[model samples]
Target: MMMLRKFKIVLPLFFVASLFISSQTNANTDPNPKDKVLLTILKYVLTQGHYHPQTIDDTFSENVYNSFLERLDPSKRYFLQSDIDEFSNYKMQIDDQINNEDLSFFFLVYERLTQRIEESKPYYKQILENQFDFNNDDIFDVDYEKSSYAKNTSEITNIWHKQLKFTTLSRLNDKIIAEEDKKKEDETYQTKSFNELEKEAREAVIINMDESFERIEELTYSDWFSIFINSISEEFDPHTTYFDPVVKKRFDISMAGKLEGIGARLQKKNDYTKVSELISGGPAWKQGELEVGDYITKVAQGDGEPIDIVGMRLDDAIEYIKGKKGTEVRLTLKKMDGTTKVISIIRDVVELEETFVKSSVVKKDGRTFGVINLPKFYIDFDEKNFRSSSTDMAQEIERLKNENVEGLVIDLRNNGGGSLKTAIEISGLFIEKGPIVQVKYRDKNPDVKKDTDPKIQWDKPLVVLVNELSASASEIFAAAMQDYGRAVIIGGRQTYGKGTVQSVLDLNRYHNLKEDIGALKMTIQKFYRINGGSTQLEGVHSDIMLPDRYTYMNIGERDLENPLKFDKVPKATYKLWDNYENFNQAIDNSKKRIATNNYFKLIDQNAKWLKNSQDDTLIYLNYEAYKKDLEVHENESLKYKSLRDYTSNLTYTSPLYEQPLLEKDEDLAEKREAWHKNLKKDMYVEEALNVLSELKIKPQYHLVKN
Candidate 1:
């Protein structure tokens, strides 16, 4: 959401694991026979364990070949037509090779890719070494998703030329703005000519590309092998992926939501490791010194000399920063304005409570409501007494019940979901022992996961808030709640649409192999709502739809490359929640309020303009036209700025018990206060309360169960 203007690189740096492998490969450059072993085990899983097993045939082989190439070079800027032609011979033969447990195709492609990368290094360097003619009347189409591979070296050279020029222009634009700002700040400030700025931009590009090539050299053969293996596994489904041991470890740590290190998401952006997001209540966020978009230039251990990480691989940089709890890691960061600072943070176990279930009490219109924000349906698998979202949510509900809340609102915005078992348990809190969801596996009839518990937690007026980012378990909870007429689903047009469930299988356990080949996360089941509708491509629809920034964006499972299709099963026999009889009237009242709401109108316009900008792929090479377009966009974007400041005249406060806890912890109190302030500004929450008010009205008709 925070867009850093000229610092943005159009290309995705590298696939997470691929770049990590590329960074750490220099020390141990040994041949890994595990590739064949991994391939064998992966194929077995796809064929035997996958929900939708793909056949290993000519068709599958050709897809594997193309998909691998696409993964290797998504921008179509690396390999050429000749490379594709040379690799065409193995297209159909890939099926035979995989069938025979061979690695010929993978080996051929990986070797050739390595060779092309080495050969193309100088091409970008030579291009960036010279000054770019920004005055030239040319436009670069940035959408390479539909573009074809280059025909020859000449064509590839042209593509590289355009790429470098585009990058240079972007950097130059940033410099010009900075110089102008400086001139305004100082009366006697001198600004450099366009040519001088152009040279600086080119030099910057050259330095970055050189660092990129050097880092590429660190890529081990095993890393590329993982990429290829993942390409094959992903062909089955987008959710299916092969994680090598290192990546698997990182994946596990991330899923656990607690790690003994600095709690900031670090990403490799052109030779610099940028702090992407800070985990709230984590070390970085708690320190309040490290910030999103801050470039980590150097890292050091406790009292140790700082080592420069400017051109270091992100994985290596992370290694220097990540330490055991109670240890210290120092970071040298570069700010956006080109200022530098040193910050030392004592590493601790950052438990990501923000991603867990949390509750707040809102008092509006002389009535009280409890809002529960469940970012993810997290579950700790290792510990027998591990905390789960279901238990946490139930506790929060009980806490809210003690406050005597008149209505309840569950906010699942941006929750990508977690344990399916947790989802069922969470849903059970609202209903009196019934089927939560129907899951279907390969060739198996739908199995109804029932919550046999007959006790209802808070079967009163309820509302759920979701957005396009809400997915999987979130969708399951929302859909089940919607089907039972237990709650009014609000926000986004639809959820993230991820209906399928993935189970991680350790490859070592598959064949009882003694080696740590890695793990495979494969989609093994698809879930359906209690009303029989699949939440696959079509996620759960909101009972009261609200427009947000992502309303017009292609960001759901349906927008993914190879997502599972939506279908239906027989509806389960279940009783609906008889709590709200005037649900339809309440929805109508909310829609009427939304129709005349100025905040929503502005949001709709912002969404439309944002989508238009996203669709605009062409970039002007001429600086004048480029600046003009950018200024137009900047001016247009200003109108939406007021939306962030828009706050409703509503009050949100913590429960009495929570207030004492907040009082004890100043940091927690501050966070909750900020959260309350944000909630006041949230138009969707305001409307949800209105829905709650309407739901509190007596029903004209009796509620019935299906």
Candidate 2:
């Protein structure tokens, strides 16, 4: 569950532990062999070809080092002066080449960023200064009050920099940057230059700034708070984190995607809670006349005239949409391509069945196998953590068995994992009693989660589907299954590879100041496979590689600031399942053949185009060129068929809701309330089903001849 801490847990930087855990670990105490061994292995794995960054000067300040140490020790549980001393051996010497002038350049850039952030303050002031016009129908059209967050970060950093009583910011950045680069080099990795990277980063920031700002308004007080806390962690290190109260609620919702509402997804598009996507089987989707991309213009309650919601905050809009499931509501919508309509539907308890164990039959190449598409390794957030995706999956396996299905394909495409407990529980359904995954914290003892339950759920021939978005818990389940030789992994190169565990911290508690601000989401520990490999940056590998745009090393936890390093520890004491080796070899052979196929080449070309399109700097041009290029590329990317995946099914090419109204509903008054319930939670269970059902071809159909 997304838990937001009500209070921050602040403390003096360190507590002397009685462990001298690793050569690089700081706790001053007798080390446990398991912990020490793990530390040594991780230190070698993460630090071997990399360098750590710091910004210390002649003053030999320890604060920068302290901050770095504090980040690794999210709980501040294991690090001590002794650990700091251990790291000192590898600390870089800040030569003149990398001194103030160089550092100041970056600081200057940061300053400009801050100035822009400050520019937003006045905008925020305008919002707060303007009184809500209750009499006017435009209350929902109120714009966001801007705030000075980026500027604040700059201010905080500058203030801290001046207080540098000890370190230089550049020195600090260089150290980490050097370390990362060295690691990359050691691995023979490919990356862009700093100049190019900066350009790319700038464009991305510019594009996302408005989007992220808008998101703040749409987010629940808790969701917004959780993200705020998470971003705070980014300031310290990609891993150190904190949380406020509301976020924890969101984490709970993620496991099940359950919420109190009409079961449709809403977005604050230009000025309203836009119906971006309608949840299948939900009240709205069942209405038959409803279309995707419908922009909701107004909403009304019992006996109340419909209130215009053009510019309302997404969170506020949500409050309007959620009520007792049996309640009735009406919506006046504008379609995207230009159409309008009034639809009335009743709300009811909407269950996300697709997030549960969904099964289908894949009949291809004269072979029939039962397919269970697990979009995510979800767990129930409700009291008692009563239900989980794995538990439900086991039940589905039983149902598939009833259908006399042969083999199984577990689809995890775009499935970012939800619950670790569920990942292990679900993996248990495949393998015999053994360690499911091996977890190692910075200074704590290694924690080995197990699937020791002797009873296996379904050990039939199986395959796991993974893609760029399959991360965290998804990697765990897939990896464990592959390790046990229970299933073959299929899809992208690996996964998103976020094998770290994060816990929310209330920074306000620790500081006892500004408790009203958001909290932090800190990375406390890193997870590993029973085989001893960390899932940090390199997610699980697939037995069968598919042509996908995300196959490149473009995203995930590794790309963030203050990220925990990837490494490995001792392998857990677990038995290796047989026959899997042979399965992998066969898969390898299949992949080799597909890699050289002509069709695959076209797919790869499209993948590259998609990737390039995401890079903003690539499209820059001076005035004339900008306009010309924009025209030429207007819909070049759209011509690609894959985008259709995101386009909701509709009869018109234009966005459904923004269109002009053809005719007003004659029964509007009668069904108005009933229709409102149909317009809320918008997820894609039905679409996912369509994907599965359509995929039910025989093995012969899987191969496409040239």
Candidate 3:
């Protein structure tokens, strides 16, 4: 079966190459011959090469059908129930059509969607022209998943009317409040009447919708086809995706960790572009104004007038936000606290240094310990001599050893993983010689990846700090340490369950075609812990769990669609390290401390509040009611403000070796200073230090001094 699986994957490459060459020479005059070629190759690779390919049967077809519609019209504002009924005919036949390389279903949906989009332009324009009755008590359900498609034109029109009204009402309230605040500051200040403010709000909505529609009109057929292809590709797993040429370039830039932009990652949430993460040492991060969860509503270049981006596509919004180095980009954000703030940042090349491993020495209760923050398990595939996480980590640990640190805390929080080879090498640094992780390709025997070198770099007590975002390579290192009793894992419930390994296959490489066919990033293998457990949907459980804001939220691999199931392989033969005299005692001591801690109690409460906020999706259209709701939420949020302000008494400082480097680079010094300040405010780091203090090393296991 293993040989057959290998043969199946290899045979297609040769077959496709010959077929592609022949097809190109005698190419049909189809508008997008590349589309058919791409579709055929993508399907072949996924089905043959995927670690756990889904049977492309009726069930898979139905999944692709539903997923495509949702991706195209998540809010159900475009396609009506009648259109869905028409498209339902191919719901079960998609499998057969895909096998036949027929794009009839995609073409039908794409054409219908384009038509609906063009026709629906007048819905928002017409609705916004008239004044909204804010006095009437109307509610709009923001949870589109629970809502059904509109039955007819009137139903869809009503849906658009309520959505526009809800948006306009919020803006009107903000305008009115701003005017009142201005009058309060200066008694001579002229305040606009309620009617005039309302009109301005409606005009803003019209401009936003018009711009959004225009952007949508600009999308090529190829753009829609990418969405269609992805809907099918993602059915196998969330990580497996088909990247078009444009998307592939962006992916490569992200991997390189060098780009000219605001250095903030944005994701499209409904009609808004939300700030997902602010890259450390980037312009936005240095500015200290933008934050995760804030919705960007408008963007302006330098001193130019702010252009509304409320309804713009994610890509389009990103283009407006990113610019050449030394340019200023201004963003108006709708803050999480129901307030708006405009922040300006001078864009610069996002420094990649922050993403690499950095260590800080801190003294707590007269004991010195080292804290190493590894953002990701990075490696440069093209340049083998380039710096990697494993090499950098070993060097950092050696530097800490020179400082005579008693214990170490490896911070893997928010690390979304990178090179698999680096993860094994890093794990090998702590252990003498043993299997670090077990990897299994489809239908093949588990391959035990071991540390052939018998040298133990750090024999001292080690504690790994992780969160829900720590994934893939992060999980591998943490899991290996946990299995071997080499380190105490601390932080969230578990790491992100991303055990699958993916390899990006350049589709254009299969044939000598000039056309850009793009690439496919597909899963090829799964990694397992040495103890036999697979970190597919159930990640490595931390020895000491910490209360975080994402505790009650639905996150991690299980929350994703079509995730691989958890399974176990035969445990690798290895001896556990018995170096610690009080490993269990340290965990118990930490747990007891956390139970009595007020900060943790407040964090738990805040997590519940956040989950409740996520679940409550209804929006009041009436101005007074909406204002009251916002005020209530704002007041409630005040109780948890101390969680942000809570700081530990411990002081963090740069190692003696880094002082000279810091003196030479002002930006580096500033970044390190900021990081140290943040460490002082980190309760988790304080707890890790406390645990490290309790972790007494056995006398026999102590390392001899040079």
- Whose TM-score is greatest here? 3
- For all candidates in order, the CA lDDT equals 0.78, 0.50, 0.85
lDDT of 1 at 140: 83
lDDT tens digits by residue: candidate 2, 444-472: 56789998788767655666777776778
After superposing candidate 1, which stretches have Cα over 4 Å from the reference? 1-34, 258-350, 380-387, 510-515, 697-706
Please list the residue runs of candidate 2 whose C-alpha ends up more than 4 Å from where it truly belongs after superposition. Answer: 1-233, 239-351, 381-385, 507-518, 580-582, 616-627, 642-706
Which is the winner by lDDT between candidate 2 and candidate 3?
Answer: 3
TM-score of 3: 0.92
Question: lDDT at 610 for candidate 3?
Answer: 73
Error of 2 at 562 (Å): 2.5
Q: What is the Cα-based lDDT of residue 435 in candidate 1?
A: 92
Model 3 residue 374 distance off true place after TM-score fit, in angstroms: 1.6
Give the distance in Å from residue 173's predicted Cα in candidate 3 to where it truly belongs.
3.2
Candidate 3 Cα misplacement greater than 4 A, ranges: 1-14, 17-30, 268-281, 284-312, 330-346, 381-385, 511-514, 703-706
Candidate 1 backbone overlaps, count: 1
Instruction: Write down the lDDT that model 1 would get.
Output: 0.78
For 1-706, candidate 1 gives per-residue lDDT tens digits of 0111212112123432342343245226425545555666577668887788888899988888887887677566778888889899998888888766577778788888888888887798788778887788889886776677999889999988887787778668767987999999997998999999999888877776665576678778767788788778888888888888889998888656656898887765544687755664578866768865577876768876456565455666787788899999988776532345679999987656666778888888788889888877777767787899999999999989888898888888767677788989999998888999998877878889899998888777889999887888889999999988889999999998988877777666544335588888888888999899999988999999999877887667776567878889999999877566688989998888888988889989988876777566687998998888777776787787899789889888887778889879998888888888889998888888889877862443224322
Supply every candidate's count of residue pairs whose N, Cα or C atoms clash at under 3 angstroms: 1, 90, 0
